[model samples]
Target: MNIFDLLLEADILVQISIFILLGFSILSWSVIFHRVFTLNIAHKKLKLFENEFWSGIDLASLYQKSLSRRNKLNGAEQIFYVGFKEFSKLYQMKRCSSETIISRTLDTMHTAINIELKTLEDYIPLIGTIGSISPYLGLFGTVLGIMHVFVELGKTTNNTATQIIHLQIIAPGIAESLIATAIGLFVAIPSVMAFNYLTTQINNLDQDYNNFIDEFITILYRQIFLNIDSVLNKENKHEETENKTCY
Candidate 1:
């Protein structure tokens, strides 16, 4: 008999199990497609932003360009914007030491990274939960189907003139029960694989954000020292000019 015929004849509980598996399969695939698209976009945006950042552009100019698209900034760009804004604020105030400014800017960037990570992780746990539970749900349906087949067989043997068993009588029922497990595995395998692949993508993006943060902070530190030296040099040149006038 065809799968549809078997499903029609299957026990009610088994039918429910199959329907649930089908639902999980649909939801899992939906999440897989969404994440694939999202992560791919994130990766491309990050690469583009990184290339622009490292192409000898000034930080203030980069910040201004990013500001134009502030609402739509990607992961790496968002980090740069947040970190640079914080550094600019603290540097302008000049009330805090350089160490304090750097520390505060680092904290702000870390918070931005966490927020970006959370956004990337949306709906991922649901996929993991479905993969973990689908097999057990299918197993439950299979066990119930087998019990139903056995109960029916006992009734038939009681009515028969001779105590005999037939392969045809049991084969269809067993086949129906096994279909639940087959569906479960079908749903689970792809969900698990997609989960792993998406998770790796997230981790890679996270690493890129961290590396950028470190490099950006180093640049900020150097700029601070350069400004200090420039001020000291200007003051020394002014004093030398005054000494020449006095002579």
Candidate 2:
């Protein structure tokens, strides 16, 4: 018999299991497609932003450009916005030491990175859950179908003239039971593969974020030192002029 015929003749429990597996398949595919699209866009934007960041542009100019798209910023750009904004605030206040400003800016950027990662990971766990449980659900249906076949066979032996167990009688029922397992694996395999793939992408992005944060912090420290040196040089020059006038 064809697959449709077997499905039509399947036990009610087996049909329910098939339907549930189909639902999981649909849901998993939806998440997989969505995550693929989103991650692609995110990676593209990350690369574009990184190129702009290292192109010898001034921080204030970059910060202004980023502010224009503040609501839509993600990844490295979002971290830069929060960190720079905090740095600017503390620097302007002049109440905090350079160390305090750098510390607070680092904290702000870390928080932004965490929030971005969480957004990237949305709905991932649901995919993993479906992958893990779909096979078991399918197996449950198969077990019920096999039990049903055996019970019907027992009833048939009591009514039939021949005390014979036929392969033809048993094969179709077993085939129907096994279809559930087939459907279950169908749903599970892609879900597991997609889950692993997306997880790797997220991990790679996480490493990129950490590296960017470290580099940006180092830049901030250099800028702070440059400003301090410039101020000290101006003071020393003024003192030298005063000493010459006294002589």
Candidate 3:
């Protein structure tokens, strides 16, 4: 039988399942493309922010600059924004002495990493669901087709008393079973690939964010505790020696 004609004979409920699977495949593909573009942008933006962060501007400056509407927020921006806000709030509250500020800042950065990862990880479950279940749903369709084929076979045996040959009995059932499995794989393969690829990219971005935060905190430690008086003393002595030598 023609594949089209077999499709025409398929039960409505089974056809609906196939349609649902197809829709899921398309949605999963769309998500894959979107995440690919977003993750690429995130990587580039992270590189940009990491460069600026290494130059040793004060945290307050980074915070304020990020808070302003001018700096475009990307994945790195979000992670920094979250950490900086918490640190600033704690500093204002006098929650830590100077000695503990760095330790507390590390905690805040950890929390920021969680928040950013969760935000990126949203919708992952749905893709996973589609991948895991689509094939079984297709199998269910095939089962229904087989059950239907058996019923028709039994009816033919009573009417003309002609034995239903195995091939005739099995033909549509075999076709439907394979078609159902094919549809399932069609939905599942791409969904699984998309899920794994997006997950890897998200992990890489998260790691980059964490590394930047760790190094950023180290930079913060030095700048905040600058001994201004020591620098002035050296400059003052240099000036005194220069004046005496001139006289």
The digit string of per-residue lDDT tens for model 3 on 186-243 reads: 8899888888888898888777878888777665555553543355446555655322
| Residue 71, model 1: Cα distance from true site in angstroms | 1.8
Q: Where does candidate 3 clash, by residue pair? A: none
lDDT for each of the candidates?
Answer: 0.84, 0.86, 0.70
lDDT of 1 by residue, 1-247 (tens): 9989888888899999999999999999999999989999988988898899889999999999989989988698999999999888866653345566778899999999999999999999889889999999889899999988877776664535433554457668978988898888998899998999999999999998899899989888886746765654565555543222211
Candidate 1 local Cα displacement, residue 91, angstroms = 0.5
Clashes of 3: 0
Of 2 and 3, which scores higher on TM-score? 2
Report residue 46 deviation for candidate 3 (angstroms): 1.0
Q: Report the poorest 10 consecutive residues by lDDT, candidate 1.
A: 238-247
TM-score of each: 0.88, 0.88, 0.77
Error of 2 at 78 (Å): 1.0
For candidate 2, write residues 69-187 as lDDT tens digits: 89988889999999999888877753345566677788899999899999999999999999999999999999999998887776655534433554466768989999999999999
Which parts of model 3 have CA positions greater than 4 angstroms off?
1-3, 55-61, 70-74, 85-95, 158-170, 226-247
| Candidate 1 deviant stretches above 4 angstroms | 158-167, 229-247
lDDT of 1: 0.84
